[model samples]
Target: MLSSWLLVACGPSQEPPENSSLTLLHPNNPSSDTETYQTENDFDLLVSDYESTQRVIWQKPDLVIAQLGDLSGKTVADIGAGTGYFAFRLVPRAERVIAIDIDQRFINFMDSIKVRLPENVQDRFETRLGKPEDPLLKPSEADVVMLVNTYCFLENRIQYLKTLATGMKNEGELLIIDFKKNNLPVGPPTELKVSTAQVKAELEQAGFKVKKTDNQSLDYQYIIVATLQKPTNKIN
Candidate 1:
């Protein structure tokens, strides 16, 4: 079992009202809930609202997809896939896409939307109910696992990465996209924001090698591509 101590970052807690559309779930403290600024029952609503308001501040999905190069026939996992937006995009590019989220409500929402997806791409997308600390993907299964705008909510960063690593095949890649701490007002609370260096350090400590880091069009976020390095041979 992975240790809980590996989780890092903490934030204020607030109870979400029954009718509240948005709820923030933190991985470090699973029992606590936080109310978000917006209220939207469906993840698509949140995505659409963000895109509309932050058109200049949001990263272009197509550009990000381009950075990933050729993914055809590759199995990818979208961790913390709140609305399956990224997963849907990956469906046509990747051989398979496992969209995982911790919230049952969100999973239900994904399932509901899955019905409307084109028949040809529908078979490539799969949904899974996941936990904050564990993504629930099978060991050595995915060629790539992506955490987009969602890594800050995690408490046990190392454990979470380890769990993800377990599900990744050798040489698998992990792509992380999150807001930069200095780019205030664009993401969560300032204190809860994570810097690229911080993310790189945490991932490195979790046994991943930083392959590339690039600034994203989003006002204060970056995209990092990291890969697990093979162990070096040791002298007997």
Candidate 2:
């Protein structure tokens, strides 16, 4: 389920407090996008939308997670991890799970859930407040990066992917799952979505080689798996 948060592309309002260093990325506040989450009621509404039980029928989270293959000791970065719907599930599977979002409320919400998890699982999950222009992942810090129902809202995606690539290993994998450009019963408006073909082209421009694509698995979304292509005639 989409969190319906189209984070406006803007700089942070102010620097994070010096003592605040819990986020995996540089802490930054989202712009005044009151429409996204103006009040506690609004936040609660969005949370319910994202964590809806009916979502399981279409999202098929377990099948989606299996597409990443083994995760015994891998690190996964879940971009736009609204309410940790997918991030928390990755905690026990991946060695490290970075749940990232631009919205502070979502981060706080996920952190609340984190505290309730078992001690071992809690240690594996980390919430990150990211910037609109960058996810702020560390150099080669992620073995796999996933964006579910979160790609279409981005601005200047090619440039964003270039920045994201620097944070992934030389041959790290990137998995993107988003709504298809069709009038589906669920998901955002078709006009606001990105097609699988467009995603493949963008991945190529961003230096990733499309490895696999699954359009039939999910009812409303398409899956794309690409690997960061190593530089040719260039040193790492």
| Most accurate candidate by TM-score | 2
What is model 2's C-alpha RMSD? 9.3
lDDT of 1 by residue, 98-143 (tens): 9998877667878988999888777888999987779988978899
Off by over 4 Å in 2: 1-41, 232-236
Task: In candidate 2, list every pair of residues with a backbone clash.
Answer: none
Model 2 scores worst on lDDT over the 10 consecutive residues at: 5-14
Instruction: Please list all clashing residue pairs in model 1, or write none if there are none.
Output: 7-155, 7-156, 7-157, 8-155
Give lDDT tens digits, candidate 2, residues 83-197.
8889988887899999999889899999998999899888889999988879999988999999987888677999999999988988899999988788765555566679999
RMSD of each: 7.9, 9.3
> Each candidate: what lDDT?
0.71, 0.78
Sequence-dependent TM-score of model 1: 0.78
